[model samples]
Target chain A: MKAIILFGHGARDARWREPFDRLAQLWQEQHPSTPVQLAFLELMQPSLEEAVTTLAAKGATDLTIVPVFFGQGGHLRNDFPVLLEECRGKFPNMTLSATPAVGEDLAVLQAIVDFGARAL
Target chain B: MKAIILFGHGARDARWREPFDRLAQLWQEQHPSTPVQLAFLELMQPSLEEAVTTLAAKGATDLTIVPVFFGQGGHLRNDFPVLLEECRGKFPNMTLSATPAVGEDLAVLQAIVDFGARAL
Candidate 1:
Protein backbone atom coordinates (compact mmCIF):
# COMPACT_ATOMS: atom_id res chain seq x y z
CA MET A 1 0.00 0.00 0.00
CA LYS A 2 1.06 3.61 -0.49
CA ALA A 3 0.61 6.49 1.96
CA ILE A 4 1.20 10.22 1.91
CA ILE A 5 2.25 12.71 4.57
CA LEU A 6 1.53 16.43 4.51
CA PHE A 7 4.47 17.83 6.41
CA GLY A 8 4.24 21.28 7.99
CA HIS A 9 6.31 23.60 10.10
CA GLY A 10 4.41 23.34 13.36
CA ALA A 11 3.75 26.35 15.54
CA ARG A 12 3.18 27.02 19.23
CA ASP A 13 -0.50 27.69 18.60
CA ALA A 14 -2.70 24.59 18.59
CA ARG A 15 -4.96 26.17 16.01
CA TRP A 16 -1.99 26.39 13.67
CA ARG A 17 -2.59 22.77 12.70
CA GLU A 18 -6.14 23.42 11.52
CA PRO A 19 -5.19 23.79 7.84
CA PHE A 20 -2.93 20.77 7.99
CA ASP A 21 -5.78 18.76 9.49
CA ARG A 22 -8.04 20.05 6.72
CA LEU A 23 -5.45 19.15 4.09
CA ALA A 24 -5.21 15.59 5.38
CA GLN A 25 -9.00 15.30 5.48
CA LEU A 26 -9.28 16.62 1.94
CA TRP A 27 -6.61 14.19 0.74
CA GLN A 28 -8.34 11.27 2.42
CA GLU A 29 -11.69 12.27 0.96
CA GLN A 30 -10.40 12.66 -2.58
CA HIS A 31 -7.81 9.89 -2.59
CA PRO A 32 -9.41 7.18 -0.54
CA SER A 33 -6.96 4.53 -1.65
CA THR A 34 -3.91 6.51 -0.63
CA PRO A 35 -3.79 6.80 3.16
CA VAL A 36 -2.95 10.30 4.37
CA GLN A 37 -1.23 11.55 7.51
CA LEU A 38 -0.32 14.97 8.93
CA ALA A 39 3.18 15.42 10.29
CA PHE A 40 4.76 18.45 11.96
CA LEU A 41 8.36 19.56 12.08
CA GLU A 42 8.32 20.91 15.65
CA LEU A 43 6.04 22.07 18.49
CA MET A 44 3.32 19.68 17.35
CA GLN A 45 2.35 16.05 17.68
CA PRO A 46 3.19 13.23 15.27
CA SER A 47 6.57 14.26 14.00
CA LEU A 48 7.61 12.99 10.59
CA GLU A 49 9.18 9.89 12.11
CA GLU A 50 6.07 9.03 14.09
CA ALA A 51 3.88 9.51 11.03
CA VAL A 52 6.15 7.25 8.98
CA THR A 53 6.04 4.60 11.70
CA THR A 54 2.25 4.72 11.82
CA LEU A 55 1.97 4.28 8.07
CA ALA A 56 4.67 1.60 8.07
CA ALA A 57 2.73 -0.34 10.68
CA LYS A 58 -0.33 -0.15 8.46
CA GLY A 59 1.58 -1.94 5.65
CA ALA A 60 2.48 1.13 3.64
CA THR A 61 5.41 0.13 1.42
CA ASP A 62 5.85 3.47 -0.37
CA LEU A 63 5.42 6.96 1.10
CA THR A 64 5.43 10.46 -0.31
CA ILE A 65 6.05 13.54 1.85
CA VAL A 66 4.72 16.86 0.66
CA PRO A 67 6.10 19.84 2.50
CA VAL A 68 3.20 22.16 3.23
CA PHE A 69 5.23 25.36 3.41
CA PHE A 70 5.49 28.61 1.48
CA GLY A 71 9.24 28.64 1.16
CA GLN A 72 12.27 26.40 0.73
CA GLY A 73 13.94 27.93 3.78
CA GLY A 74 16.38 26.49 6.26
CA HIS A 75 13.73 24.16 7.64
CA LEU A 76 13.01 22.60 4.26
CA ARG A 77 16.58 22.73 3.02
CA ASN A 78 18.42 21.78 6.21
CA ASP A 79 16.19 20.29 8.89
CA PHE A 80 13.94 18.31 6.57
CA PRO A 81 16.68 16.44 4.74
CA VAL A 82 18.22 15.27 8.02
CA LEU A 83 14.88 14.06 9.29
CA LEU A 84 14.16 12.35 5.98
CA GLU A 85 17.52 10.65 6.08
CA GLU A 86 16.76 9.39 9.55
CA CYS A 87 13.39 8.12 8.42
CA ARG A 88 15.04 6.38 5.49
CA GLY A 89 17.53 4.73 7.83
CA LYS A 90 14.76 3.58 10.14
CA PHE A 91 12.46 2.37 7.37
CA PRO A 92 14.98 0.65 5.20
CA ASN A 93 12.38 -1.59 3.61
CA MET A 94 10.01 1.20 2.60
CA THR A 95 10.44 3.53 -0.36
CA LEU A 96 10.26 7.17 0.71
CA SER A 97 10.35 10.24 -1.52
CA ALA A 98 9.49 13.93 -1.34
CA THR A 99 8.25 16.63 -3.65
CA PRO A 100 9.15 20.32 -3.72
CA ALA A 101 7.27 22.58 -1.39
CA VAL A 102 3.66 23.09 -2.47
CA GLY A 103 4.44 26.79 -2.81
CA GLU A 104 6.61 25.95 -5.78
CA ASP A 105 3.54 24.84 -7.71
CA LEU A 106 2.23 27.41 -10.18
CA ALA A 107 -1.37 26.32 -9.70
CA VAL A 108 -1.10 26.90 -5.99
CA LEU A 109 0.22 30.41 -6.58
CA GLN A 110 -2.53 31.08 -9.10
CA ALA A 111 -5.12 30.00 -6.58
CA ILE A 112 -3.74 32.50 -4.12
CA VAL A 113 -3.82 35.21 -6.75
CA ASP A 114 -7.42 34.36 -7.54
CA PHE A 115 -8.29 34.52 -3.88
CA GLY A 116 -6.76 37.99 -3.64
CA ALA A 117 -8.59 39.09 -6.78
CA ARG A 118 -11.90 37.96 -5.35
CA ALA A 119 -11.23 39.72 -2.06
CA LEU A 120 -10.54 42.92 -3.93
CA MET B 1 -7.41 54.17 -6.69
CA LYS B 2 -7.21 50.61 -5.30
CA ALA B 3 -4.18 48.37 -4.85
CA ILE B 4 -3.13 45.06 -3.32
CA ILE B 5 -0.27 43.86 -1.16
CA LEU B 6 0.72 40.22 -0.88
CA PHE B 7 2.10 39.83 2.63
CA GLY B 8 4.31 36.92 3.62
CA HIS B 9 6.44 35.67 6.48
CA GLY B 10 10.04 36.34 5.53
CA ALA B 11 12.83 33.82 5.77
CA ARG B 12 16.58 34.04 6.30
CA ASP B 13 17.38 32.41 2.98
CA ALA B 14 17.06 34.88 0.08
CA ARG B 15 15.87 32.21 -2.33
CA TRP B 16 12.85 31.70 -0.14
CA ARG B 17 11.30 34.78 -1.70
CA GLU B 18 11.28 33.41 -5.24
CA PRO B 19 7.65 32.25 -5.07
CA PHE B 20 6.62 35.54 -3.56
CA ASP B 21 8.37 37.39 -6.34
CA ARG B 22 6.54 35.27 -8.89
CA LEU B 23 3.25 36.02 -7.17
CA ALA B 24 3.86 39.76 -7.43
CA GLN B 25 4.82 39.41 -11.08
CA LEU B 26 1.69 37.41 -11.83
CA TRP B 27 -0.52 39.93 -10.08
CA GLN B 28 1.07 42.82 -11.96
CA GLU B 29 0.76 41.06 -15.27
CA GLN B 30 -2.86 40.02 -14.78
CA HIS B 31 -4.10 43.13 -12.96
CA PRO B 32 -1.90 45.96 -14.10
CA SER B 33 -4.38 48.63 -13.17
CA THR B 34 -4.77 47.48 -9.57
CA PRO B 35 -1.04 47.55 -8.83
CA VAL B 36 0.68 45.05 -6.48
CA GLN B 37 3.37 45.11 -3.83
CA LEU B 38 5.15 42.50 -1.72
CA ALA B 39 5.59 42.87 2.03
CA PHE B 40 7.17 40.75 4.76
CA LEU B 41 6.60 40.45 8.47
CA GLU B 42 10.26 40.06 9.32
CA LEU B 43 13.75 39.21 7.99
CA MET B 44 12.91 40.60 4.53
CA GLN B 45 12.72 43.89 2.70
CA PRO B 46 9.61 45.99 2.16
CA SER B 47 7.69 45.81 5.40
CA LEU B 48 3.92 46.18 5.41
CA GLU B 49 4.21 49.88 6.19
CA GLU B 50 6.61 50.34 3.32
CA ALA B 51 4.24 48.61 0.96
CA VAL B 52 1.37 50.74 2.14
CA THR B 53 3.48 53.81 1.61
CA THR B 54 4.41 52.73 -1.88
CA LEU B 55 0.78 52.23 -2.82
CA ALA B 56 -0.17 55.48 -1.18
CA ALA B 57 2.37 57.32 -3.27
CA LYS B 58 0.96 55.60 -6.34
CA GLY B 59 -2.39 57.35 -5.64
CA ALA B 60 -4.05 54.30 -4.12
CA THR B 61 -6.73 55.35 -1.67
CA ASP B 62 -8.04 51.86 -0.96
CA LEU B 63 -5.71 48.92 -0.36
CA THR B 64 -6.21 45.24 0.36
CA ILE B 65 -3.61 43.12 2.10
CA VAL B 66 -3.63 39.39 1.53
CA PRO B 67 -1.74 37.34 4.06
CA VAL B 68 0.18 34.69 2.15
CA PHE B 69 0.50 32.37 5.10
CA PHE B 70 -0.78 28.85 5.55
CA GLY B 71 -2.01 29.06 9.13
CA GLN B 72 -3.43 31.85 11.27
CA GLY B 73 -1.03 31.33 14.10
CA GLY B 74 0.55 33.96 16.33
CA HIS B 75 2.00 35.63 13.28
CA LEU B 76 -1.34 36.20 11.62
CA ARG B 77 -3.65 36.43 14.63
CA ASN B 78 -1.32 38.48 16.82
CA ASP B 79 1.59 40.06 15.04
CA PHE B 80 -0.17 40.97 11.82
CA PRO B 81 -2.89 43.04 13.48
CA VAL B 82 -0.30 45.09 15.28
CA LEU B 83 1.53 45.72 12.07
CA LEU B 84 -1.64 46.61 10.25
CA GLU B 85 -2.59 49.02 12.98
CA GLU B 86 0.77 50.70 12.74
CA CYS B 87 0.37 51.04 9.01
CA ARG B 88 -3.07 52.55 9.52
CA GLY B 89 -1.63 55.03 11.93
CA LYS B 90 1.13 55.92 9.53
CA PHE B 91 -1.16 56.13 6.54
CA PRO B 92 -4.31 57.40 8.12
CA ASN B 93 -5.87 58.68 4.90
CA MET B 94 -5.56 55.34 3.06
CA THR B 95 -8.39 52.84 3.37
CA LEU B 96 -6.79 49.56 4.33
CA SER B 97 -8.38 46.15 4.88
CA ALA B 98 -7.09 42.62 5.16
CA THR B 99 -8.47 39.22 4.28
CA PRO B 100 -7.98 36.00 6.17
CA ALA B 101 -4.88 33.99 5.42
CA VAL B 102 -4.87 32.49 1.93
CA GLY B 103 -4.82 29.07 3.55
CA GLU B 104 -8.31 29.80 4.80
CA ASP B 105 -9.55 29.90 1.23
CA LEU B 106 -11.19 26.71 -0.02
CA ALA B 107 -9.87 27.15 -3.53
CA VAL B 108 -6.32 27.48 -2.27
CA LEU B 109 -6.68 24.36 -0.15
CA GLN B 110 -8.23 22.48 -3.03
CA ALA B 111 -5.32 23.52 -5.23
CA ILE B 112 -2.88 22.10 -2.69
CA VAL B 113 -4.83 18.86 -2.55
CA ASP B 114 -4.76 18.65 -6.31
CA PHE B 115 -1.03 19.26 -6.32
CA GLY B 116 -0.53 16.33 -3.95
CA ALA B 117 -2.80 14.16 -6.03
CA ARG B 118 -0.82 14.92 -9.16
CA ALA B 119 2.47 14.10 -7.42
CA LEU B 120 1.15 10.72 -6.33
Candidate 2:
Protein backbone atom coordinates (compact mmCIF):
# COMPACT_ATOMS: atom_id res chain seq x y z
CA MET A 1 0.00 0.00 0.00
CA LYS A 2 1.10 3.60 -0.53
CA ALA A 3 0.95 6.34 2.12
CA ILE A 4 1.49 10.10 2.50
CA ILE A 5 2.84 12.26 5.29
CA LEU A 6 2.11 15.97 5.59
CA PHE A 7 5.23 17.30 7.34
CA GLY A 8 5.17 20.63 9.10
CA HIS A 9 7.44 22.85 11.19
CA GLY A 10 5.91 22.47 14.63
CA ALA A 11 5.53 25.33 17.01
CA ARG A 12 5.34 25.84 20.80
CA ASP A 13 1.61 26.51 20.64
CA ALA A 14 -0.55 23.42 20.73
CA ARG A 15 -3.08 25.10 18.48
CA TRP A 16 -0.37 25.41 15.84
CA ARG A 17 -1.11 21.86 14.80
CA GLU A 18 -4.77 22.60 14.04
CA PRO A 19 -4.21 23.09 10.32
CA PHE A 20 -1.97 20.07 10.10
CA ASP A 21 -4.67 18.05 11.77
CA ARG A 22 -7.17 19.47 9.33
CA LEU A 23 -4.89 18.67 6.41
CA ALA A 24 -4.58 15.08 7.50
CA GLN A 25 -8.36 14.86 7.96
CA LEU A 26 -8.93 16.36 4.53
CA TRP A 27 -6.47 13.93 2.96
CA GLN A 28 -8.03 10.94 4.68
CA GLU A 29 -11.50 12.00 3.61
CA GLN A 30 -10.59 12.47 -0.04
CA HIS A 31 -8.02 9.69 -0.47
CA PRO A 32 -9.35 6.85 1.59
CA SER A 33 -7.08 4.27 0.01
CA THR A 34 -3.88 6.19 0.50
CA PRO A 35 -3.32 6.43 4.24
CA VAL A 36 -2.17 9.85 5.45
CA GLN A 37 -0.27 10.94 8.57
CA LEU A 38 0.74 14.25 10.09
CA ALA A 39 4.35 14.68 11.15
CA PHE A 40 6.12 17.60 12.77
CA LEU A 41 9.74 18.70 12.67
CA GLU A 42 9.95 19.87 16.31
CA LEU A 43 7.98 20.84 19.40
CA MET A 44 5.16 18.46 18.39
CA GLN A 45 4.32 14.82 18.47
CA PRO A 46 4.98 12.18 15.78
CA SER A 47 8.26 13.31 14.32
CA LEU A 48 8.93 12.17 10.77
CA GLU A 49 10.49 8.95 11.99
CA GLU A 50 7.51 8.06 14.14
CA ALA A 51 5.11 8.76 11.30
CA VAL A 52 7.13 6.55 8.97
CA THR A 53 7.08 3.75 11.52
CA THR A 54 3.32 4.06 11.85
CA LEU A 55 2.84 3.90 8.09
CA ALA A 56 5.28 1.05 7.78
CA ALA A 57 3.23 -0.87 10.30
CA LYS A 58 0.13 -0.18 8.24
CA GLY A 59 1.82 -2.07 5.32
CA ALA A 60 2.74 1.06 3.43
CA THR A 61 5.51 0.28 0.96
CA ASP A 62 5.91 3.54 -0.94
CA LEU A 63 5.64 6.76 1.08
CA THR A 64 5.63 10.33 -0.17
CA ILE A 65 6.46 13.07 2.35
CA VAL A 66 5.06 16.51 1.59
CA PRO A 67 6.51 19.48 3.42
CA VAL A 68 3.61 21.68 4.53
CA PHE A 69 5.45 24.94 4.71
CA PHE A 70 5.34 28.30 2.96
CA GLY A 71 9.08 28.61 2.50
CA GLN A 72 12.01 26.38 1.59
CA GLY A 73 14.23 27.77 4.28
CA GLY A 74 16.96 26.10 6.35
CA HIS A 75 14.49 23.58 7.78
CA LEU A 76 13.46 22.27 4.37
CA ARG A 77 16.83 22.90 2.64
CA ASN A 78 19.14 21.62 5.37
CA ASP A 79 17.41 19.72 8.16
CA PHE A 80 14.73 17.88 6.18
CA PRO A 81 17.19 16.02 3.94
CA VAL A 82 19.08 14.72 6.92
CA LEU A 83 15.89 13.53 8.59
CA LEU A 84 14.68 11.91 5.37
CA GLU A 85 18.00 10.16 4.88
CA GLU A 86 17.82 8.84 8.39
CA CYS A 87 14.30 7.56 7.78
CA ARG A 88 15.42 5.89 4.56
CA GLY A 89 18.38 4.28 6.26
CA LYS A 90 16.27 2.99 9.12
CA PHE A 91 13.60 1.65 6.81
CA PRO A 92 15.72 0.14 4.08
CA ASN A 93 12.88 -1.99 2.73
CA MET A 94 10.47 0.91 2.18
CA THR A 95 10.61 3.36 -0.73
CA LEU A 96 10.58 6.90 0.61
CA SER A 97 10.46 10.09 -1.47
CA ALA A 98 9.67 13.77 -0.94
CA THR A 99 8.21 16.63 -2.93
CA PRO A 100 9.27 20.27 -2.72
CA ALA A 101 7.53 22.45 -0.16
CA VAL A 102 3.84 22.93 -0.99
CA GLY A 103 4.54 26.62 -1.26
CA GLU A 104 6.34 25.88 -4.52
CA ASP A 105 3.06 24.80 -6.07
CA LEU A 106 1.47 27.42 -8.30
CA ALA A 107 -2.03 26.29 -7.51
CA VAL A 108 -1.42 26.70 -3.81
CA LEU A 109 -0.16 30.22 -4.35
CA GLN A 110 -3.13 31.01 -6.55
CA ALA A 111 -5.47 29.79 -3.82
CA ILE A 112 -3.87 32.21 -1.38
CA VAL A 113 -4.23 35.01 -3.90
CA ASP A 114 -7.87 34.16 -4.36
CA PHE A 115 -8.37 34.15 -0.61
CA GLY A 116 -6.85 37.62 -0.39
CA ALA A 117 -8.98 38.83 -3.26
CA ARG A 118 -12.14 37.61 -1.58
CA ALA A 119 -11.16 39.25 1.72
CA LEU A 120 -10.62 42.62 0.02
CA MET B 1 -8.25 53.81 -2.27
CA LYS B 2 -8.05 50.21 -1.06
CA ALA B 3 -4.95 48.00 -0.91
CA ILE B 4 -3.77 44.64 0.46
CA ILE B 5 -0.79 43.36 2.39
CA LEU B 6 0.29 39.73 2.34
CA PHE B 7 1.99 39.21 5.67
CA GLY B 8 4.22 36.25 6.47
CA HIS B 9 6.70 34.94 8.98
CA GLY B 10 10.17 35.67 7.61
CA ALA B 11 13.00 33.18 7.43
CA ARG B 12 16.77 33.54 7.68
CA ASP B 13 17.28 32.23 4.14
CA ALA B 14 16.81 34.99 1.56
CA ARG B 15 15.41 32.56 -0.95
CA TRP B 16 12.53 31.76 1.36
CA ARG B 17 10.63 34.81 0.18
CA GLU B 18 10.26 33.65 -3.43
CA PRO B 19 6.60 32.62 -3.09
CA PHE B 20 5.81 35.87 -1.31
CA ASP B 21 7.34 37.82 -4.18
CA ARG B 22 5.37 35.75 -6.67
CA LEU B 23 2.20 36.41 -4.66
CA ALA B 24 2.79 40.14 -4.85
CA GLN B 25 3.43 39.91 -8.58
CA LEU B 26 0.29 37.88 -9.15
CA TRP B 27 -1.79 40.32 -7.14
CA GLN B 28 -0.39 43.26 -9.06
CA GLU B 29 -1.02 41.57 -12.37
CA GLN B 30 -4.55 40.43 -11.56
CA HIS B 31 -5.68 43.41 -9.51
CA PRO B 32 -3.65 46.35 -10.66
CA SER B 33 -6.04 48.87 -9.22
CA THR B 34 -5.82 47.46 -5.70
CA PRO B 35 -2.11 47.57 -4.90
CA VAL B 36 -0.48 44.81 -2.88
CA GLN B 37 2.57 44.77 -0.63
CA LEU B 38 4.52 42.03 1.12
CA ALA B 39 5.42 42.22 4.80
CA PHE B 40 7.29 40.00 7.22
CA LEU B 41 7.14 39.57 10.96
CA GLU B 42 10.90 39.18 11.36
CA LEU B 43 14.20 38.36 9.58
CA MET B 44 12.94 39.87 6.30
CA GLN B 45 12.49 43.24 4.71
CA PRO B 46 9.39 45.44 4.77
CA SER B 47 7.91 44.82 8.16
CA LEU B 48 4.16 45.27 8.55
CA GLU B 49 4.58 48.92 9.45
CA GLU B 50 6.69 49.54 6.37
CA ALA B 51 4.09 47.88 4.15
CA VAL B 52 1.35 49.97 5.70
CA THR B 53 3.42 53.09 5.12
CA THR B 54 4.00 52.16 1.49
CA LEU B 55 0.29 51.66 0.89
CA ALA B 56 -0.49 54.85 2.76
CA ALA B 57 1.83 56.79 0.49
CA LYS B 58 0.14 55.18 -2.51
CA GLY B 59 -3.09 56.91 -1.43
CA ALA B 60 -4.64 53.80 0.07
CA THR B 61 -7.13 54.77 2.74
CA ASP B 62 -8.47 51.27 3.40
CA LEU B 63 -6.07 48.32 3.66
CA THR B 64 -6.56 44.62 4.27
CA ILE B 65 -3.79 42.43 5.64
CA VAL B 66 -3.89 38.74 4.85
CA PRO B 67 -1.68 36.54 6.99
CA VAL B 68 0.01 34.13 4.63
CA PHE B 69 0.54 31.51 7.30
CA PHE B 70 -0.53 27.90 7.69
CA GLY B 71 -1.32 28.15 11.38
CA GLN B 72 -2.51 30.68 13.91
CA GLY B 73 0.17 30.10 16.51
CA GLY B 74 1.81 32.60 18.78
CA HIS B 75 2.98 34.52 15.78
CA LEU B 76 -0.53 35.10 14.53
CA ARG B 77 -2.51 35.09 17.78
CA ASN B 78 -0.10 37.06 19.89
CA ASP B 79 2.63 38.82 17.95
CA PHE B 80 0.47 39.88 15.01
CA PRO B 81 -2.18 41.78 16.94
CA VAL B 82 0.54 43.84 18.67
CA LEU B 83 2.17 44.67 15.35
CA LEU B 84 -1.16 45.55 13.77
CA GLU B 85 -1.95 47.82 16.70
CA GLU B 86 1.36 49.63 16.31
CA CYS B 87 0.73 50.14 12.62
CA ARG B 88 -2.79 51.34 13.33
CA GLY B 89 -1.44 53.76 15.87
CA LYS B 90 1.01 55.19 13.37
CA PHE B 91 -1.33 55.21 10.41
CA PRO B 92 -4.32 56.44 12.33
CA ASN B 93 -6.08 57.87 9.33
CA MET B 94 -5.90 54.68 7.27
CA THR B 95 -8.59 52.04 7.76
CA LEU B 96 -6.79 48.77 8.42
CA SER B 97 -8.31 45.33 8.93
CA ALA B 98 -6.94 41.77 8.92
CA THR B 99 -8.40 38.42 7.99
CA PRO B 100 -7.70 35.09 9.62
CA ALA B 101 -4.65 33.21 8.41
CA VAL B 102 -4.97 31.89 4.88
CA GLY B 103 -4.75 28.40 6.31
CA GLU B 104 -8.09 29.04 7.95
CA ASP B 105 -9.69 29.31 4.53
CA LEU B 106 -11.46 26.17 3.31
CA ALA B 107 -10.50 26.82 -0.31
CA VAL B 108 -6.82 27.11 0.56
CA LEU B 109 -6.95 23.88 2.57
CA GLN B 110 -8.80 22.13 -0.23
CA ALA B 111 -6.15 23.31 -2.67
CA ILE B 112 -3.44 21.77 -0.51
CA VAL B 113 -5.37 18.51 -0.29
CA ASP B 114 -5.71 18.52 -4.08
CA PHE B 115 -1.99 19.14 -4.46
CA GLY B 116 -1.23 16.10 -2.34
CA ALA B 117 -3.76 14.05 -4.30
CA ARG B 118 -2.14 15.08 -7.58
CA ALA B 119 1.30 14.14 -6.28
CA LEU B 120 0.14 10.70 -5.25
lDDT of 1 by residue, B74-97 (tens): 999999999999999998898999
Which residue runs of candidate 2 sit more than 4 Å off their true CA positions? none
Q: Between which residue pairs do clashes occur in model 1?
A: none
Record all residue pairs in model 2 with backbone atoms less than 3 Å apart, i.e. clashing. Answer: none
TM-score of chain B taken alone, every candidate: 0.98, 0.98
lDDT of each: 0.94, 0.94
Q: What is the lDDT of residue A98 in candidate 1?
A: 98
What is model 1's interface RMSD?
0.6
Worst 10 residues of 1 chain A by lDDT: A14-23
